[model samples]
Target: MTHSLDPAALDQLFLQARTFNKFTAEPVGDDLLRQLYDLYKWGPTSMNTQPGRVVFVRTEEGKQKLKPALMPNNVDKTMAAPVVAIVALDTAFYEHMPTQFPANPAARDLFASNAGLSTDTATRNSSLQGAYLIMAARALGLAAGPMSGFNPTMVNEAFFPDGRWKANFLINLGWGDPSGNRPRGPRLAFEDGVVLA
Candidate 1:
């Protein structure tokens, strides 16, 4: 058997998965969430140090727990989504560099010695991974709504009591209906946003 796909399908996928503000009543099961994670976790990372940790808040209790962590504006939309994911970073990501970056133990030492530096790197890299997750969901024919409009302190308190993780952002994933989304916002032109130095 031969594999086949239409190149135009990718374009359609991208166009279809706008920032979905509204979702249907359909639920996003754990299996599909795992598939999404599997696809996005393959994205590039510095020294292959995969620091991003995802927690899917799917149950009513989970969503209720998340409410206190969300900003007032985010609570409604978050509660309505089929699945809400808490994207976070593990501060001890460098501890695993022995396996993730076996050739460069020095890189691991750099982060392991400095607590502040470790947190910074983990947060930055995990944010990149979160972006990869959104794109991956789109590629998988799912819609995503990523938001920074949440109380990081509250989220950390509710989710990572031991202080092993830091909140990066929240992503709501599901089948977004057009009725729930607003008109597409304007973007900067290439010349206006790019620097060709």
Candidate 2:
């Protein structure tokens, strides 16, 4: 049984949440990252394939490894962030369906037999999970900066050398420094973006 969340919760998760550009000296530790994962990992996926894999880059060495892969505009903030999550897609995600979706053991073959289906599922669902991560971060009083200004090929080579997983996007996580935020942008009215049944 569920009811609507209070206005403050809605504000925290959506209305007032902002994509942070700079962070304070505060560091995001491993324990908090785990809690964030535990909250968002339940956002449903097709057959519960749950193909999202996250790599939290929190050390100076890790930041250096990520630097060359970022676009010029994204470099400074990413390096300064306490943790940069490498939200990735597991192409071979179906390997776990037998265990994750035990009700239909044949679910593994359904995706494994078709490469096209597998890739499409991996991308769509992993992206969905990434969105969940941002919302989860906001709920936990953290600011998130999700970005696309990076070279996928470079990131893949640097972070996922074995080729089992591929980078989808990066999210810089920490306590936001509001001074670095850009002015708020406008959003389309609901009628402009959606169609009612």
Candidate 3:
């Protein structure tokens, strides 16, 4: 499906999606979360070799399991958020590359025999997907808090055993409490961060 976003309108969503440190004691509905996932899962991936695997920590038990995995500063806010998503990369993402990258048989063989190549592709593509998920959530009028301070090994052990998934990052989702938002952080200016040829 061909889709396009108006740059100006997209910027508005970017402006709204700020880090939410606090949230109301409200819960996000499972159906809404599912819808969000459905939308995000369709975002582009390298060769369409989708590598993202999301573990939604919604239940009290699941949230409790996440506590031991989060850094001290992130634990309380994570627990309080309506949803904490554990975004992971599937190590075997390329197994289906024959179909996803069918245009070139070489694409299928590219990572088939090399463990390092498979791992690198999965990590990079899943990271890209995670960013798309954040934008999709923002477009849906949801607040997001993206974080990297977490124990990946612990998260994998708690959520995925047998090495099926590798944790990438954690994103808390819910309606924002204006009182919980941090001031917009400074960003590098275009000239400072980007160069045009």
Candidate 4:
């Protein structure tokens, strides 16, 4: 069996991690963002259909383009963050299934033949990848503020004008300023939220 992670590792990844509202003035470099993607991409998706796509908006110009799409509450904090990741889903992701799921060359055709199944798989897998992105950022010592308050139409028009990809959510990434953190909230117990077979 795989050994359990140490307490400190657990704390960093889950126990003590916070969804930061503000960040330090320091920038998040391209190298670290690359590393973050490298780490998170290892997470599994059904039939290896990795449908998640991300656009990292770091430049002033890009942020300006994104600004009009954001909700009023999300605008300020997102602008203040070093980088904002627009996590997206590619509806045409199945086109790559032939190579991605090589063991089953028929997979691409399977999804292509059924648009509903293709969309469902793409959405579910991309959402899972967005969660993996946050965990990967935590593992790499960055704080992530994941939010879903933007107008999808506005965001899509601004970022994915061609319409191949759709926004799943957004995450603000940076070195956190602890003073901006809210008091930790409570979670539901397993017994209340989960069911045993």
Q: Each candidate's TM vs. the true structure?
A: 0.92, 0.98, 0.90, 0.98
lDDT of 4 by residue, 1-197 (tens): 49999999999999999999999999999999999999999999999999999999999999999999999999999999999999999999999988789999899999999999999999999999999999999999999999999998899999999999999999999999999899999999999999998
Clashes of each: 0, 0, 0, 0
lDDT of prediction 4: 0.95
Q: What TM value does model 4 have?
A: 0.98
Encode model 1's per-residue lDDT on 9-110: one tens digit a residue: 657556445798888988887899989988999998888888999999898998998998788888899999999989999988998898888888698898
Q: Model 3 misses residue 140 by how many Å?
A: 0.9
Order of the predicted models by lDDT, top scorer first: 4, 2, 1, 3
Q: Model 2 over residues 1-197: C-alpha lDDT tens digits? A: 38999999999999988999999999898999999999999899999999999999999999999999999999999999999999999999999998999999899999999999999999999999999999999999999999999999999999899998999999999998999999989999999999999
Better of 3 and 4 by TM-score: 4
Kindly state the number of residue pairs that clash in model 4.
0
Model 1, which residues run further than 4 Å from truth?
1-7, 13-16
Cα miss at 127, model 3 (Å)? Answer: 0.6
Candidate 1: deviation at residue 193, Å? 0.7
**Shift of residue 28 alpha carbon in model 3, Å:** 1.5
lDDT of each structure?
Answer: 0.87, 0.95, 0.86, 0.95
